[model samples]
Target: MAKTFASTGDTAEKTITFAEIGEGLYAFTAEGDPNTGVIVGDDSVMVIDAQATPVMARKVIERVRTVTDKPIRYVVLSHYHAVRVLGASAYGADEILASEATRSLIVERGKEDWESELGRFPRLFQAAESVPGLTWPTMTFPTRMTVWLGKRRVDLIHLGRGHTAGDTVAWVPDSRVMFSGDLVEYHSACYCGDAHFADWPKTLDTLAAYNPRALVPGRGDALDSPKMVADGIALTRDFLTTLYDSVSESAARGLTLKQAFDRSREVMDPKFSKFAIYEHCQPFNVARAYDEARGLDHPRIWTAERDREMWEALQG
Candidate 1:
């Protein structure tokens, strides 16, 4: 697969690319960094996800201003992650929407996650001083909801918990375009530090059932056809499977987490070495996989302290 990864500030200004993926719909992706999507309708606009901080969000706003003057009526939280949801207030959105599980996760571990992420990815959280605090969604859904911006229909579906319990994918059926949050990443690393690996593939099946003609992945460029869409989903699935299998095998041999990280890296680096944040992700991915392989179903909360401990343990 062809790939390009731009590692920079939260905005990743030089690498940011916005493409008109569907009619009146746009995808703003920053190389292999986090991305934001826009759906402009006759009456209002909906932003798929806000960036890390208000300062970062301003870049998205500036881009939106270039295309439409309509008010941003809603900010959709694809999942409850610091990088995805913290800049919400900047949108001045009437409603910030999320799934019930995401809301619960926010209450359960949002603060620690905010601290942990801020400590680890200082670059992504640029303008960290501007974050008001952990962002909470004012509105939420249990399974599915279709909201209409005038006549355009955007279906928000909670297919199943994979990356996180409350992950949601925004699908625009008429246009055959889907904005798959972190649920889909084109050629980037999957931050499975908090993922449900066993359940993730099933969720991918649900996403594939839609057969989107075009997809705005969690990161990377927007895929423009069914062939590429299938390739993207398949690649993401392979990534999850490879990480999990390597750790499960390592743990079976009674190896340490660091050992598992080393083994996994040896196997995956040749293929995934160039993926964005590949270095930062390997240790954490192995730790989560080790936990899950030992029959731990849910990912343990990650605190700033835990982040440091894990990084130190596996910083090879």
Candidate 2:
């Protein structure tokens, strides 16, 4: 298999792959691109995180058609990222769902996020021209909600914020399977443009409580077995912890952003260099961590221009 990531000039945007992680849950991952998940139950199918556009989502729908003919009843937005939720139209579900906070973020900065993400990673969008607009959830919940896949019992919850303010998960209680958005990753890079470093670990703890037997991560290969699932959760937490600590230490020492970025890489590289998206994720990771170290609660919006500016500053 190809490595999870590579920097092949601007043309390299990573590749997408559909993998079956559990009996009925699937992980659709790209080589460091945004990831999506699917849950098939007795009555209907629920897709987590529509790709960037209807054309792109059709690709996923094609994959779904191979296995089942059940109608897609729900499209779940794990968060409000442009690359993740914009393709919801293709599902044509009556009720799209998300955390109430996610709905608020969509109302607040959804357009900006669309522009920002579209600018940053164009390849993942597949059919950029086909994007209808920012996707909005029809139904919103405060924290947790449960849906029976005709009695399969999939729980959707916003336990805590890790990747974004409205991150959600699709968990099967009986099967002990979970589709963690960007909250947990196996090897693919974790995007942190709007991450909450301090609060993410506690949220992770809540996820770990279940000790899932299988997990389809936000990106990377599917993890099977309780050991692999636990490993995924632990590695993700470690990444957040290490990134935050290094950036916090740099701020405490009063380093400049560029200086802090370098410091963060120096601190995290030896152990994480082989991990997916290490290079690509480092710059944005440092920016968010630096803000949090200074006591910023929620992450600020990331503009396309800002992404380029920051990438140039750190990557140079």
Candidate 3:
């Protein structure tokens, strides 16, 4: 039998957890769903990645209210993923910030991504109609920007491209806690549909240089220790390397995409198959890796139609 298309079959709801990694920084995470980071500065709060929809984002808001009633002042888009940015409206944040590259992507393919992702993972978009439209960043920075809530300083840095052409990480200088958006996933599979495979590891290296005391990853449980932080980064690096190495080797040998996919499974399954969204991500991951290995520097835009076509071609 053919496998389910993307995460459409993943209808079960996951329990949410809100854990404090730093003094005022929190991680709002579901079982292995997309995670959101919260930074409570002295005056207001800044959210890392919004949930999939307004309804989904409210869950994060509810958790935020439990600890502090300070208004959510800023909403940060880690990259241009529908599941991460569509919930911006719910925050009612004064500013929606993203990298310039991310804003360009939104202008380029945000509408198509919204449609494609809604089809791929229906569960995440709890109230699809609630989305106002393609989320637009109210503010954008080319490389790095800083915001201060009272005296607490939060630096938003576009370290390098990894998960997407534009990926930004929020760093709390005071607590040494880093909110690494999809750049580093804990136990969950890194969705490489728009990933920069070769650049990803170098970005990871830049992130490691900070030696964050505690880190909140894009998914899975929050890493509250330096050891766990290192481990998470290492695990992400290993996953990317193993997949790219196997798929690239196949591409180098002139294997077909299907042949490359099968070969990748044989190599990646033993270690990463058990990860959340591992199956959901493999086809796209294999396709992108194959392309990059064969010299595609930029990722192709994924549309609802292309999503189905790719799934049918690979999963069938």
Q: Which candidate is the best by lDDT?
A: 3
Q: What is the TM-score of each candidate against the true structure?
A: 0.95, 0.93, 0.99
Q: Candidate 1: lDDT of 72?
A: 98
**Over 4 Å off, model 1:** 1-14
Please give the RMSD to the true structure for each candidate, in Å.
3.7, 3.4, 0.6
Model 2 error, position 128 (Å): 0.6
Across 168-252, the per-residue lDDT of candidate 3 in tens digits comes to: 9999989999999999999999999999998999999999999999999999999999999999999999999999999999999
- True lDDT of residue 313, candidate 1: 64
Question: What lDDT score goes with residue 103 in model 3?
Answer: 100
The CA lDDT of each predicted structure is: 0.88, 0.83, 0.95
Task: Compare the candidates by TM-score and give the number of the best one.
Answer: 3
Candidates arranged by lDDT, highest first: 3, 1, 2
Model 3: how far is 159 from its true place, Å?
Answer: 0.4
Q: List the residue pairs that clash in candidate 3.
A: none
Candidate 1 Cα deviation (angstroms), residue 57: 0.5
TM-score of 3: 0.99
Ranking by TM-score: 3, 1, 2
Please give the clash total of every predicted structure, in order: 0, 0, 0
lDDT of 2 by residue, 30-105 (tens): 6666677888999999999898899989988998888889999999998888878999999998789999999999
